[model samples]
Target: MNRRDNAPGASADIGAALYGLATRAARRLPRDMSLTSAATLATLDRTGPRRITDLAAVEGITQPAMTTLVRVMEKSGLVERRGDASDKRVTLVCLTEAGASYVRTRRQAGVHAFERLISELTGDEVEALVAALPALKHLADLESQDREGQNQ
Candidate 1:
């Protein structure tokens, strides 16, 4: 019998466990900005500049909501709107130096937090996590591809 078939609720259990870990980890981060705002900055950092509509779609928010977010981020000097070189009518939101710095700092903080947490695990337990890294990364890649497909 397939192992998956043998475990009817294994997937759900794993999802719940992962969600719990994520929730707890997120709480360790600074709450200066909304999750959406941080996500927006991360997107810009990864994909360079993007239109507000694209950002909204990627973040699963409305264009108007993204426009408002852009406004706020712009005011905070984390992002700036610029005319698209190829399409002057379209505006792209780009991350400022400060925004990139914030992303880096936040990422480092998260890494440090996880490092401390991981250090508490037994050697075998840590090995289990290390073994699971590929699968976890693949899951993330799948989700990213799904989001990209939806936007397209």
Candidate 2:
């Protein structure tokens, strides 16, 4: 049997293809917004309010850097810093209504672009992809868990 039949290489090739597709799709987004800022807003919108320290941890950035990012985002009306009701000293970062809308808009654009890209695929290929969605979600969860473990 030839080495070309190896499963690991095929899996790596699939991963690289997916990564390239995602990178290209991300490039289609608005140039005015940094990917980090967009990601932060989307995270806040999806997860609700979080402390600045926690947000920094989630975003894998330094606390001071996250502070600067929050300040800029706040000025752009994409995020708001509000004092926690239980502890007035603690500030919680939450997405503004406009931020939530912006996230939704960006998500829609990504979906549209992905759909258009896959429009040429055969029905069987589409069905295979749909069937793989659950496994893909599980893989994502596993990856997130690994990252959290490493952080701790």
Clash counts for the predictions, in order? 0, 0
Give the Cα error of residue 79 in candidate 1, in Å.
0.6
Clashes of 1: 0
* Candidate 2: residue pairs that collide: none
Decoy 1 TM-score against native? 0.92
The C-alpha RMSD in Å for every predicted model, in order, reads 1.6, 3.5
lDDT of 2 by residue, 30-139 (tens): 87788888978877976799887877887789999999999999999989989999999999998999999999999998888879967989999999999989978987
Q: C-alpha displacement of 98 in model 1, angstroms?
A: 0.8
Assess the local accuracy of residue 38 in candidate 1 as a C-alpha lDDT between 0 and 100. Answer: 95
Model 2 global lDDT (CA atoms, 0 to 1) = 0.86
lDDT of each: 0.94, 0.86
